[model samples]
Target: MTAPTLFHVAILRTLLIVAALVALESNRLEAAAPEPTQKIASAAAAFLDTLDDTQRGKVSFAFNDAAQRIRWSNLPVSMAEHRGLRMGDLKANQRDAVMNLLATTLSKMGYEKVVGIVESDEVLRKQSPKGAPPFGRDEYFISFLGKPSATEPWMIQFGGHHLALNITIAGEQGVLTPSLIAVQPAKFTLDGKTIRPMGRETDKALELVQALTDEQRKQAILGSQMRDLVLGPGHDGETIQPEGLKTSTLNEAQRKLLLELIAEWSGIIHDTAATAKLNEIKANLADTWFAWSGPLEAGKAYFRIQGPTVIIEYAPQRLGGDVTMHIHSMFRDPTNDYGKKFAGK
Candidate 1:
């Protein structure tokens, strides 16, 4: 039998959140000495115990019994209001503790992406809200992992409004790749500088598309009329036919640029885990594909990068009110998403 768990209430809750986000087997968890969820749950509980009641509630996962130790959900793309509770609403110490809890669990789960996110969070906290803060204030969500480790991939669901970062780390040497990152700024202007939330993604994608010759471009643009990013959340590697672009169609230079474009965004984690994935992508460089739709300019557009395992897509959504062109982009591995994607022959 397992040792009686030793953790505080909030920590237990948070660990459970991570556990729910991740799919795990108890037997496997026990084999990994200390256990991921148990360890993370212990750490999170310690953190919650350190918090005041108000602070605990602020950063707590707002959900019902559906909130399991490994299935707590929180990452919503739209910037909706009343995203349960928020760490932003917590006190300074409490907020720090909340973030610290996340970072610590990330490390335990063998996901290094949180290091950069942790550092970025500090900077964001200090920097004045970028213009209108991209999306609504209450558009973010938070979930934790009760137990997470390389053996069992557990994650924390936290995003919304101008944010999307679903971190899932599992297996012996798996790294943390933020599943989604999106933002819609009312307009660019951060500290007098033109600042776009995903300028890097836009510029790189545009550059790669422009690099294609007239003939090569046509080969990729299967459709003429532009619309939305066909490959949205519900459609993860759905169409088996491999529509849009193919890397083989491009010349040597164009192909290299395609790699660079995708790599640029993947570089966000800035950790060993990212490097490992990078090496794998580099090896599979040849058998990849790149596709785009709409005018090369920055209005409405859609682009996709697909490889044997890696797939990244970007598209500008309709913005009727304020944002004339919004962005929706994502990266996923066919067989490695959340380390659990089924494909029956």
Candidate 2:
């Protein structure tokens, strides 16, 4: 190989300097990025920056507005008016910003679940009966109960027909409670891939129930039928007396199955937040109860997992033609809904 001329050497030197500058800039950006604990708040702030004053006012509410905190539902906006900036009204960039906040707040699977639920509504939109309320992905709304801060309490309320996520953030903790995760067409196809918003929730619960011994099943089954959610939507801060078999009775294998089932809900938030939440749930597993009210052979069923800190219910809507086609599930932290404990309500 020939030695490079002075001109070639100078050009190579210039290129190396440019590459170094680029790497330095990339490193600076990476360092400036918020940590996992702060991402949700940072994303919320970034979203706010994208909005004008009027839009910001529409999306923000006082932290102490108790009414606003519980003003969420699984009903369409036409039936229950939402107090936030409508997804449909947002500009492209603004809408993207809101989605970014959601992605930042929830785990990958959780974010996909939310999107799937919304897309299922879009499916419902096209199949709506005459004069029925509107249904679509764009019908969802996003609101913030307080200014987003990493160390102080705040909330993010995002929901629409058949879905509601009430995520509260305080310090390094992020709580997803009193959230409704539901879908009208429980199964659908998006981008050519089959999507079931609550698929894992259904499958995992089924696996747990199926793993039960004969005696265990008898203890787990409920006498009465459950057609809908008892603690969904408006039923916040309330819990039914736990029924069914206590998790403490489960063998180690069955216990593991139960924890996996619970994770379908607790693991919906960002991993860092989910890990803390899961640890608490595991600690209380001994006191947790698992109850089922449906067929043991096959098909959809209604099940409830109630413990000291968590109450999760999965009820497939029976009145909606095909019971398996519509589903509603609730996730609540009885002691910390809306971060009440963290905020010292």
Candidate 3:
């Protein structure tokens, strides 16, 4: 080609610079955009691909099937009580795929808590009451509601004895509520380390409750005992009158303690979603109430925090009058369980 004139060369340089600037702006826009849920959708698809036809049939459920969505329980699969594909039935590869799916939805801490709860069941199996059905890590089940999609609503239901995680995703938002995490032999020795899956939950609440003055404790303590969560599985969309000491009455230090307790549950979801949920709860702190039952000792008491958007309960199972070793806890959003906000329910 012939050499360009000075004017033409200047114009060409200007166009090239403009194009380079445009490309950089485009890259910046792409990076700043919110991440799509396609990663989770792809992970779910991969997990399903690992399943055989029969397993897939068992694992998948209709999204609108209210009965199936609420069919989860805190009973071991050995009891033949839950409906879904059992981890015990899966091969190593299939199990890994299922875990990969969980990693996509739960934060690193959330995923670790789940695995810890499942492993704790093995301890329960060894310490079981005579002839009390089998309990172990393999007893957990994984189920899906609707087809996984980045732009559509779907849910992942995974639970077993002492654990339930119900995660609903719609567009860019995810809700993890109406979830249960508990432990039998609430504290146990594993690999020479004492593990307490629900320890932060139990200890943190106890700290807050104990910090209250005798007068404050009187206001915070409930007259009636809470044997189980009022809004546990199958108790969807229910509301309870706010009770006990209101956050408005708490001093700044005490309010901080309460927020930390709430984080034990809300922080279980991925960081972005958890931050959003925590912000919502914090905004309504003045209207929130903390109620307590039983003794103030860790692992032995029952307590709940209720607010406009959140309800969390920690109850120790009282089978045969034995309460200290077994526990049950739930976290729920009264306004948005199962992504009701996005579903327009």
Candidate 4:
């Protein structure tokens, strides 16, 4: 072969080799993505099976891994509205047993926060709109990536109507923030009781905004209140910016309030690990932005706190089937988007 021709062939070979390496890495990353429901669904089903016949009876006829994708509206966990999978279904004693089951599952998953929120939900569900189902009655699906457990690295996600919790344990350097928590009240009544769900989380956020000396309010409030969470379902992993609120301008009091606001938000997590994540968010609070829109009232308003540590959003919507008020909220982590297992950054 000619000398020039030989050099050209070598160049082509190098390009092919580079392309091949890129393709291989891309495929590997794709495979590393998380798969939650399928992995834990069987175990969830088995756990349900282990329940005594009486306990199983408390579960909605529709409850099970197979029913993971039911229409959000057709939720079965709400008892009075859908008339299934509720505390009433369980004898008082069995209710605690049910908690035990959930706790076991979380331990098996290597995190108790999973059950912590469940317990919190149980409280909220009791206060669900009369003639309606449990709050966040939608399925609690579990997903996973590589099984690093709490030891190596892994992610487990549990979400529904008003809750979005993602725990990414990447060795000891893990992140459970960027978490989301939401609650809704129909007409502001709870569990046939008049309690308010999320009232504290919401109140604290506004209190912090209000405490901001008048000038700080102008920066923190960020225009008008929103009618709904600006970033909704399909908008997942999409962040909004030049980010209206920044922690840069705030008084010592306002900064403390910011931590207070985050504290209220993080209080929902039932696990120490989740709480530790909240504290990290608190520690990084100054690096985050607190933004709210609309009237910060019980009716017709929305808010969000987005920063390096966590993203919390609150929205009000028309009640489903009943006239009670509605709310949709979520918490997402900065580094934990999708899952950090394969996310090299």
Candidate 5:
């Protein structure tokens, strides 16, 4: 071949720069400890060690138990009656250990968000009528599916009214899906500061919707009005025909907003797993879809982000007097909910 020209040299230099950037991103995603799986497994085992035989028997379940896998809801404990060790029944130290395990499993913001959801229940409890269903942070329950192990598949089920966190762990992987995160009186005061449990979720969604062009907005809005989540609790192992504006059609700026919106849910898991899961979602962003229902400018609305590996929905409850005050949302992976892909279930 003839000697390379100046144009060829310039092209080669540009390609090398792009390759370096790709390698840098890959390293960032893989930078966590070799195994967050082991850390979480150990924390779980430590939590179990704090329990007595009776507590252990009540808190543990067969990993593949179909019923337990689907036994989570957004209703209050008095109405739905969750299975597992009630946080209210645990000793103070045991409760602390439970919190420790939760902190270990979720990202810092995620842990704060989960705590805020639980605390929001207390706020609702005070405002609820005397005959309303019971509500309180203490009513939350925690259970383990199968024994905690670094190399084996298992899960953590923790939830109460308006919250359900189903985290599955297998090896270096962590999964959070089929989770129900809701809150009544969505805004409240805690320690003289305002706390909105699902604040980022709502704000980011609205920002993304508003950023779209009028034509794009038309494509994003669904044909039907969605008053509540279509794939909320009890709708496990279900798939819906993808609807709304395809991510492929979005401009670069709009797509970035979409990923930020997705991170509000997927980022709740531990950093190691969340980074990997996000990278996976980003890789498939072109195939994802974003659907919205109800108001496009503000107030209460419903939105969804769906892709090959993930499904997320946010809906404001209509039963509550002010729709904005009560919100219900879901995050799920159609292919890997409960880590079934890793567990071979």
Candidate 6:
């Protein structure tokens, strides 16, 4: 080969420098944006490492086991409705490891909400009537649907009386639908502070309902009472007819209120997943429907928001003949429950 001229040599050096700069920039971006799925899997493995063999037996299950995947309920463990490793069985260190795993899977706000819900259950235990099932912070169970892997699908199912957080991870995406959160003795004093676990969900929903016009109210109010969530627990992959008022008919202010109401549920997951869900709902806003039942007043009521891929329901339980003090609510994605997209179902 002929030796390059000075001009050719200079051009070659410039191209080489440009290539190096591009490679460095790519590496920086890659390092900065680690896959969240890997973080979740690492956290999950760390948690499992802290468990003894016997505890592992209780916490681990086949990912494809359909029964185990659906083996969660709002009822207390004393009711014999759920199975997994109970939080009470874990040592303090082990419990902290579990919380770390949850932190990896949820946003800060979402993590706080989960902790609040569990703590509220402790309050419920104190106020339960005679013969009621055992209720407390430690009554919650945590289980892994499959072996944790950065590239594979798995689930983290944690729940107890009045709370169930079913978080599914499929590659880079995470789904927090098919989760239930409720509270009994809804308002309680703890450490000299009042705590209501589902307060935002209740209040935001009521605010939206109250903002409706007379005609909007007529279209949105249900003729019959909704005593409980239509898609709670075992009712996964179910669909409900869009009832009540459609979002397309609502004024811009009313529609904004509706979005805020939906966020109270969607915001319970990590921000990335929550943002994806909220955008999905917003894209389908025109098709979304809102329905209400019972007294529209502040203390007690039932409401539902249903759309193409989302479903949210709030129902107050009549336990102890006090409708206002007990509540049940759920968030579900009909098309993506259990991370069906990642499962290739």
Tell me how far the alpha carbon of residue 85 in candidate 6 is from the true structure, in angstroms, after superposition: 1.0
**3 against 4, candidate with superior lDDT:** 3
Candidate 1 — what's its lDDT?
0.54
Model 1 segments more than 4 A misplaced: 1-85, 98-138, 148-152, 171-178, 321-325, 341-345
Compute each candidate's TM-score over C-alphas.
0.65, 0.88, 0.86, 0.57, 0.88, 0.87
Worst 10 residues of 2 by lDDT: 28-37
126-245, model 3: which lDDT tens digit per residue? 877887877988888899988887767889999988888989987678899889988787778889998877788888888898888889999999864555677777688788887789
Per-residue alpha-carbon lDDT of model 5 for 201-226, expressed as tens digits?
A: 88889999999999998999985465
The per-candidate count of clashes, in order, stands at 21, 0, 0, 23, 0, 0
lDDT of 5 at 209: 91
Screening candidate 3 with a backbone cut-off below 3 angstroms (N, C-alpha, C), the clashing residue pairs are: none
User: How many residue pairs of model 4 clash at the backbone?
Assistant: 23
Task: Tell me the TM-score of model 1.
Answer: 0.65
Write one digit per residue (lDDT tens) for candidate 2, span 1-345: 998999999999999999999999866654654477477777898999999999999999998899988888888889997889999999999999999999999999899889889999999998889898999988999999878876678889999898889888877678898788888898888789998888888788888998999999999998646547888777776769989999899999999898888888898899988989999999999999999998863337889999999999889887578878888889998899888888766
Give lDDT tens digits, candidate 1, residues 1-345: 765465666788998988976655554555664344454445556656766776555455422222332232223323234333465555566556556655554433222333323333333434436553433333345654323343444555555543455555444343333365454442344456554546656777777878877887887776755556554444644644466656777778876687777765565542455566777787776777777777777545677777777777776666534323356667677766544431111
The number of the candidate with the highest lDDT is 5
lDDT of each: 0.54, 0.87, 0.84, 0.51, 0.89, 0.84
Q: Candidate 2: TM-score?
A: 0.88
The TM-score, computed over Cα atoms with residue i paired to residue i, of candidate 3 is 0.86
lDDT preference between candidates 1 and 6, better one: 6
All candidates: CA RMSD in angstroms? 10.2, 10.1, 7.5, 12.6, 14.4, 7.8
Worst 10 residues of 3 by lDDT: 29-38
Query: Order the candidates by lDDT, highest first — what do you get?
Result: 5, 2, 3, 6, 1, 4
- Model 2 residue pairs with clashes: none
